[model samples]
Structures are given as structure tokens and as C-alpha cells.
Target: MTTTDADAVRLVLEGDAEAFKILVDRYYDRCLRLATHLLGAGGDAEDAVQDALLRAYRHLGAYQERDKFSAWLFRIVVNQCRTLGARRRGVQALHERAWIEQGDGEPAEEHPADREATREELQRALSRLDADQREAVVLKFAEDMTYDEMAAVTGVGVSALKMRVQRACKRLRAMLTETNHV
Candidate 1:
């Protein structure tokens, strides 16, 4: 976490309610990116992150000072993504197809063809993961959270979070390889 974020969180906890806006502003984009990757769309990810932010703001007093605020926020986002994922199970096939089609059109100048292909392949693989595994991967790679922090937020054992991340990595590697992109 950045010093600014930590300070903002500290301020919010100390009853300076407006300080929470700084935290939200700092994390919103990152949280949205992670959520979009996990939830598989801009709309769903935005919705989930917004919901998580509201919950986090409401429960700011409940947050422990010992925990990293970023990790706690990620946990809330992950849970919201899981709920969205569960609701999306039946439509996953359509969602996957749509995601592929939508993702295939990345700007060539911004991302080379090979890079775009790799990104799409990885996105598909990520979409294939179970909610927990996906959360583990996103939090580990995208947020760069430690196993202990992930465990604290996820309410799981550190070993379990590590195992989930390992499994997710292996699965992602296999999927990418199968697509001849790894």
C-alpha cells in the first residue's frame, strides 16, 4: 500500500469520513482492473467494485489497523466478484465467447498482435478458473499481496492460499500452452 492510501485509511478510521474518498480514488482503478479480469467484463466488474467500495465505506470502523487496507479492500472485491461469478455460471459459455470476440480487437499499436493474442488466451484461461482460484491468482499477481495478507482477507489458512495460487498458476500455464501461446 502507498503511504497516501495508508494515511487516508488512518484518517477514515479516526472519524474523518471524507478521507475515505482518497482511498477510494486511489484504489478504484486498480480494483476495477482486477475485478474486470476476475469477473470477465467491464460492466460486471464495475458493479462488483462499486458494491465492494460501498460495503467497505460502511464497515470502515470494523477494519483492523493491523491489516493492510488494500488487502482488506481486495477481499471485499473478490467476494463481490465471486457472487457475480456464481450468478453468471449458467451464462458462462456465452460470456466466454463474447469476451473473446470483444478482446480480440485490441489496438495493434498499443499491443502487438502476439501480445494481444497472449492476453486473450490468458483472459480465457482466467475465466475458466473457479472463483476462489481466480481470486487467488488476481490478488497474488495483480495486487502483489503476500500469502499472509491474502489469508487474512480471505479467511483461509496461508498454506491454503498458497496452494490455491500454485494450482491457479499451473492451470493458467496449461491453458496457455494448449493455445500455443505460452
Candidate 2:
């Protein structure tokens, strides 16, 4: 049987520390993805996620069962990213390569070099976005989250999140167009 998140949390709180690893294992990839998009670099994102996961473990006692554990943990990740991102601003170049490379092991449907160029172009455009807008876009589209779920993680109102996404999309399109023309 599949163990639910709530069950894992209960096991952890009930003194089974190893149970916590289950929770971490389940959510680690998602947390890393969010952090990577928010922080805009794999190394920074990894550091932020490690700190966030540590903080989550330390504060596990305060976690209430009423809230979904993923949302609660994501809030921590978002906050950590914000703190790290502020510290990193101005020190990191705007055009730094920010994505983590992944291979699916399937035969290539598209030319690898062309795919890489397209990916780099998109990353450049994303890096140009305001942090808030980028977060909104990443959560909405990249992470495939609903507005309600995003609001829970980000603590931003649904309408505001919608506006950010709309603006981000418009900006990304313009930026991508400008790049293609050059």
C-alpha cells in the first residue's frame, strides 16, 4: 500500500525519525524544481533547498495536520529562495546559465543541439523577468500548479497571482521574439 503524506508525518511526530526521510524523498524533486526556477541557478537552488529542508525538519514540531504537508514545506522553500535570491542579486550575472540538465534516455525526437539552443534562449528570457513574476510563471506553468495551490505556497492572493502570470507571459513572449529577431 502507498503511504500517504499524513501517515508519514504522523510516524515522524510519533518518534520514528526515519519516517521523515520518506517525506523528504517524496517532495525533494518538486522542491528542487521550485528552488531552481526561483533562484535561477542549480548551485544556489541546491543550497537553498538544503537549507529549507533542514529548517523544515527543525520546525517539524510546529507543523499542523490541518494543512497539506507539501504546501507547508513549499512555503519554507519559497522563503529560503527569497532570502538567498536577495543575497545573490547583483553578485550573479543576469545571463548566467540557470537550468539543470536532464536526460530522459529516449531516442531524440529533436536535434540535441537545436534543443539546447532553444532551452538556453528560454532561460535567458526567464532570467530577465522580475523575481515575483518569474515565481508566478514557474509555479503556474512549469510546476503545473493551480492558483489555489500556489496561493497556499506563496501566500499571495489568487487575483494577484493571475495578474503576475499574465504579465510574465506577455513579457516572456516579447523577450523571446526580440531574441529570435536578433
Candidate 3:
């Protein structure tokens, strides 16, 4: 039988240290995806995810049973991403820089032409969004979390998260429309 995160946590707390691997295996992909979008994918994103997981493991004892485990873990990842963002201070992402530098060169290795173009346009729009809006949109759409879940993860009021996502969607639509029209 597959172990739930709560079960894994309980086992880990009960001195079954190896049980933590279950939690790691369960969350690795989802956490990595969240970190990648938040930090724009590179060593920084990887480091942030690693640090977040480490922090989660170390603080496991402090984790309250009342709170959802995923929310607890995601909050740590968000904090790590925010710390990395603050350090970067508006620095452009490696992918963005590459897109500029390689303008007429061969397209990125895998993404087909139209799909890649659309994705690039979306990434540019996402980058243009402020951190709060970006987080809101990513968590909402990319992670497919509901408002309540987002609130639990972010500690922001539901209304505020709604506002952020609404604004982000409007901006993304406007930007994509402009690109498509051109």
C-alpha cells in the first residue's frame, strides 16, 4: 500500500528515519515544478528546492498535525524561493537571457515551433508579473490548487489571492493577445 504523507511523517517521527524518503519521493516532482516556476529554473531553483526540503526535514518535529503536510512543505519552498528572489534583485533569468542572445539561432532543443513560441510568450508575461501575482498564478493554475489551498500555503487572505490571480490573468491575456496579433 502507498503511504500517505501524514503516515510517512508519523513513521519518521517514530524513529523510522528512512520513512522520510517516502515523503520526498511523493513531493519531489511537485515541489520541483513549483520551485522551477517560482525561480525561473536553474541552479538557483534547484538550490532553493533542496534547501526547502532540508528545512522541512529538520523542522519536521515542529510540524503540526492540524495543518496539511503539503501546505507546510510548500510554505518552506515559497520562503526559499522568496529569499533567492530577494538576493537576485530583479536579475534576468538564464532562460530569458538565452532567448535574447540566441535570437536567430536554433530554437531550444525540444519544444516544437508553435508550442515553444506560445510558451515563450507566456514565460515573458509571467516574468513581467510581480512576485505576489506570479506566485498566485503559478499556484492556482500550474499547481492546480484551489483558493483555500492557496491560502493555506501562502497565508494570504483568499480575497488577496483572488485579486492577485485576477490581475495576473488580465495581464497575461493582454500580453498574449498583443503577441498573437503581431
> Candidates' TM-scores?
0.75, 0.82, 0.83
Cα lDDT tens digits, model 1, 20-134, are: 8888888899888777767766588889999999999988878886777888898898788778763332111111121232224532232354655556666677777877787
Number of clashing residue pairs, candidate 2: 0
Alpha carbon lDDT at 103, candidate 3: 24
Task: Give candidate 1's root-mean-square deviation (CA, Å).
Answer: 7.3
Candidate 1 local accuracy as lDDT?
0.71
Give per-residue CA lDDT, model 3, range 23-116, as digits (tens): 8888988888888878876788779889999999889999998989998999899899998883322322223222221224543343454565
lDDT of each: 0.71, 0.77, 0.77
Cand. 3 Cα-lDDT: 0.77
lDDT of 2 at 41: 60
In model 1, residue pairs whose N, Cα or C atoms come closer than 3 Å (at least 3 residues apart or on different chains), thus clashing, are none
- Give a tens-digit lDDT track for model 2, residues 1-182: 98999898888889999998998999999998888777766588889899999999889989888888898999899999888863333212212122221234332243555766767777777777888888887787777788998999999999999999888777876776678689
The list of candidate 2 runs beyond 4 A from truth reads 86-113
